[model samples]
Structure formats: structure tokens, C-alpha cells
Target: MTPTFSQLIRSPVLFLAFGFGSGLAKKAPGTFGTLAAVPLWYGLQFLSPLAYMAVIVITFALGCYLCGAASTKLGVHDHGGIVWDEFVGYWITMFMAPAGWLWALYGFVLFRIFDIAKPQPIGWADRKVHGGLGIMLDDILAGIYAALVLQGTAYLISHF
Candidate 1:
């Protein structure tokens, strides 16, 4: 069942899995969910790289269960409303990124592009993987792809 805003607000799991209601958007819920992550990213930006990475690791691990339980309740696989994956994915993309909103915006666009395009193994995982892990895997791949590209671009711009 597609969770209504009321339902999302009422349930803690749904509230989190649905990206605090950003995923309830009628159009491009993933995009909205990713956007929601940007502000939260600011909070983590000050941490040491190791601490930041630790947070991502924890979030990813917890997300598997959070997303899975949510999907089970909704009786759907990878519901668009199930956007906790997007949150973690975007965080991964921004890992070690420059401290600025421009970088954040760039990471957002790159992550979204890779996510929507779903090339190769990312697409493969999306089609083949199951449960919450399945939902998170594709976006994780997309974030990795985007992070490589973003880091490369940042390096080039800095060096040139």
C-alpha cells in the first residue's frame, strides 16, 4: 500500500523510510528525497572523514532493515516512497566532497543522473536483487559511480 502522508507521520519507521515525508511527492519522489538529504548532509560535514564514513556505514547497515521492514508493511518492493536508500546514497556521493553547496548540488545532480540511468551493474542489481538490500544496492552503486566522477572532477578543477 502506498503510504499516505498521515500514515508516514504516524509511524516512526515510515517517517524515516519515507525520508521524513519528502518521498510522498507525487512526482520524482527520489529526487525530492535526495534533496531532503542535502540539509542533513550539512550536519555531518564537520565530522572527521573516519567519523563521517562510520556514520555512512551505520546508516547503510540500518537502512537494510529499516527499508525492508517498511516494504514488508507496504507490501511492495522498492516503493518510491521507500527513500531511505536515497538518503544514504546521497550521503555516500557527498563523502569527502568539498564543503560548499555547489558541490552538494553537483553531487545531487550526478547521483540523480546515475540513479536514473542505472547503467550496467547498477541496473543489473536493481533487476536481480531482492528485499531491502535490493532496494539499497542500486542506489549505492549509483552513488559510488557519481562519487568517482565527482571526486575526479573536483581533483581536475583543483589541479588545473
Candidate 2:
């Protein structure tokens, strides 16, 4: 069925709910979904870094509330359409990367690896939490892991 534009913009909760659908894509949907976040991320760039981080924090908080409701409404836990979490998570991933294509590419690869692999704390959060926060926290941690790696990689590349 075609989703209405309103359904597309879903009450804040449903908007995040739609992000989960990205996970449902047959291949590389998560990467594509994360890439979709770039526009929003670009919009956030006008804000000071602190302000940008604050927006991400707020998005995450809202994600938990809305994503949970949408999941229950859809009778699915972490349904694929709830990609707002990915948006937020990936934005957070790019938080520390250098502002360039190369760094963005590295951030994307690292974020995807940590996200898909669910390494360490990410895996723990994925397993222990439920609902929207559970769905989002894993990616947030993965983003953090990606950011750290990207930062370090940048430092190394500069020295070489």
C-alpha cells in the first residue's frame, strides 16, 4: 500500500517508525538510509556544534517515545521503517569526522561495520534494551565507535 504524506511524516513517533523500514530493504538499505540522513545533517550544520549535538540528543529522546508507540501500533518490535533512529545515529557518527568526502566515507564504513556487527556495548544495548531506545541506542553506540575510529584514522592519515 502507498503511504500517505502524513504517514510519511507521521506524528513525530511514526516519523521515527518509518526509519525502521529502511532495515527491511533487501540490500544496503541501512547505508542508503544513513545516507538519507545527510540532508538533515547538513541542515543541522548551521547550528553551532553544541547546538547540533543538542538537537541530536533531542531527536534521540523523541525517537524513544515515538518509536515505541509506532512499534506497538504496528504490532512489530523495531519495525524497519523507523529510520529516524538511523538518521540520528549516523549524524552522531559524523559528529567528529573531518568535513570532507573522504572522512564522510570512512565514517560511513565504520558506522556500518559497528552498526551491523553490533560490537561490544552496541551489542549489549541491542540485547538488553527494548522499544525505540533499544533500537536507537545500538546505532548511537556504533556511531560513537565509528567517530572514534574516524578521528583516529584522520589523525594517522595526517601524520603519514
Candidate 3:
């Protein structure tokens, strides 16, 4: 039987599970899940960039623990519902980008490609690792890849 929203949210395993629920939508749940992180990014912007980066670091660390517990409880491997990783990964992807829709869109596209393609080390981590940290690490790598590519693209554009 399918679990209710409350059951999913209230699970002791991970607070990120509730956020991951955004990924449960019929279409592009991962995208939706990433989108769900926007408000959080905005809210976090109040802190200095350093503090914001620290928060992301903490969130990733905590996400590792929470995601592992929640994934076990749900009896699914990297279930769609566990998208807190995506949220954090996407946030990381936009690290130095402007807070405009254009940049957001670029980040969305870049993150999605990296997440979906799972190139090299990201793919290696996804396969060799287990639990929340394992689950989130791949996405984090994807975000990093996207960030690097986007940063380069922006630099190239500026030089033109």
C-alpha cells in the first residue's frame, strides 16, 4: 500500500524525506524536487556566502545520515521520494551564479544533465556507495560538474 504524506514526512529517518516527496510527482520529479529548493536557497542567501556554503556542507553531511535511514525504512534504493540530495546538489550548482531566472534555468539544465548522465566518478560513487551519503554524493558531484561547466561557459561568454 502507498504511504500517506504524513507518514512519509514524519518518518524518523530523515527530514529530507519530506522534501524528497516533491519528487513524487508524475513527471520530472527530480526537476520538481530541485525546484522545491529555490525558496530555501533564497532564504539561505541572508547568510553571508561563507555561511551559506557552510550550511550546504552541513546539510550534505546530515543528508548522508538521514537519507541512509530513510532509504532503509522505505525499503527502496535511491527512491524518488528521497530528493533532499537533489535539492542540496542544485543549490550547490548555482554557487556563484546570479539570482536571476536565466541563471536558474541554466543551472536547472546543467544539473539535470549531470544528474541524469552520471559521468565517471559520479557514476562510480553511485554504484560503489550505499546509504544517504552514497545517494547524495553522486548528485553533489553532478552539481560540481555542472558548476564547472557553467562557470567556464560564463567565462567564455564574458570574453567574447
Best-fitting candidate, scored by lDDT? 1
| Candidate 2 local Cα displacement, residue 144, angstroms | 0.5
Q: State the lDDT of candidate 2 residue by residue for 20-60, as single tens digits.
A: 34434556656777877776776775678899889888988
lDDT of 1 by residue, 4-89 (tens): 88888899989999999999999999999999999999999899999999999999988898899999999999999889999999
Q: All candidates: CA RMSD in angstroms?
A: 0.8, 2.8, 1.9
Model 2 TM-score is 0.84
Report the CA-based lDDT of candidate 3 relative to the real structure: 0.80
**Model 1 poorest 10 in a row by lDDT:** 1-10
Q: Name the better of 1 and 3 by lDDT.
A: 1
- Model 3, backbone clash pairs (residues 3+ apart or across chains), number: 0
Better of 2 and 3 by TM-score: 3
lDDT of each: 0.93, 0.75, 0.80
Where in model 1 is the C-alpha error above 4 Å? Answer: none
The candidate maximizing TM-score is 1
lDDT digits (tens) for residues 35-116 of candidate 3? 8987677677567779879988998988887778778877887877677888888888888766677877888889999999
